[model samples]
Target: MDKIIKTSKTIRAILKVLFWVVAVVSVVILAAILVALFMKGGTALDGGFSITLGNYSLLLNQEYSSQQLTSLHFMTFANVALFGTLSCYIIRVLLNVFEPMSQGKPFSTTISVALKKLAYAILIMGIINLVLQIATNLIFYNVFDIPSLFNADRVESCSISIVSDGSFIIWFFILRLVGHIFKYGETLQQLSDETL
Candidate 1:
């Protein structure tokens, strides 16, 4: 019993460290991405990479007027049902495995600690996507409402060009998909339990 407790304690400690590390890294990376985006989008972002800080207003520029940004955003949202289904459908289902981890003795000792790690990740991504959605919408509705916000002076979510990059699109899809997969796992576990 003592050994099991110690092992669980160690795993919990490791998980705590890993969780904070992931959270910190996520924040830092997000900040850097915002900074980079600002630099690339506006006058405030014009310095060297190390000192680079550009205009936040440029986000309103529809940066890909010449590219496919508009279509990409449309595709992402238009297929949100598909995206949601494909991305988060079963990710949460597997969470039941850990549900017992909280109470000590679980239905399946076979559940790997890795599942905990993965569930942690999916939760984060789901939250981040929700936050990003809200933030972008606020920027569109409020931030861009200011007359001087943009160089060319535009106000629309479609006017924003963050979606212009294909790589960014791919990255988002990957994150969303992983989150969904994890959610599906959690959900399936729940549904099975309900039937049983």
Candidate 2:
């Protein structure tokens, strides 16, 4: 029990530090994007960062429709930055959940509530990421008119995958189960205390 408490405390400390780091980084990135947008006088699609994934040989050098501003690209960057912020929030919630455990109150209602919130946060983040990926892909396909061959093979192969991070959904269910267990434990503790 002492070891568990010590470990939880250590992990909570680490998570707190990581949460702040991610929060600061997310703010910085969003600020930089805004600054670039203002100075460049265009949307994120205009003179913004470009990234391409996959084999260069199979890919046709994917590019956006125009070098001017576009709402789609801006939304993509916003979504990514929002996702980072949400991730930090999730870490903060996890830290909260660990707090009672580190103090040797593992089955408290507070812990259960925090775990439920953490699970919901994970679910929300996963959904938002999926939506953003789908919107970005749709925008990319519509704006950038690639050849049929490249679109059929290379684009499909290189598109952002939705199944890669499906573990979050599983984790959500697990967290809910653990929360219910904690609630039950708390109830048992209450009954034992009353009898004593």
- The RMSD (Cα, Å) of candidate 2 is 4.4
lDDT of 2 by residue, 125-157 (tens): 888877877877766655554244354754555
| Residue runs of model 1 more than 4 Å from their true location after superposition | 41-196
TM-score per candidate, chains pooled: 0.29, 0.77
Candidate 1 residues 1-196, lDDT tens each? 4555555556655655655555565456545544444343334322231211254323333223212223333333333433343233233333333344544543343354434444445554555455556555544444324444435545443232233223434554565565556566666777888999
Which number leads on TM-score? Answer: 2
Worst 10 residues of 1 by lDDT: 44-53
Candidate 1 TM-score versus the reference: 0.29
Candidate 1: lDDT of 72?
Answer: 31
- List pairs with backbone clashes in candidate 2: 43-69
All candidates: CA RMSD (Å): 13.6, 4.4
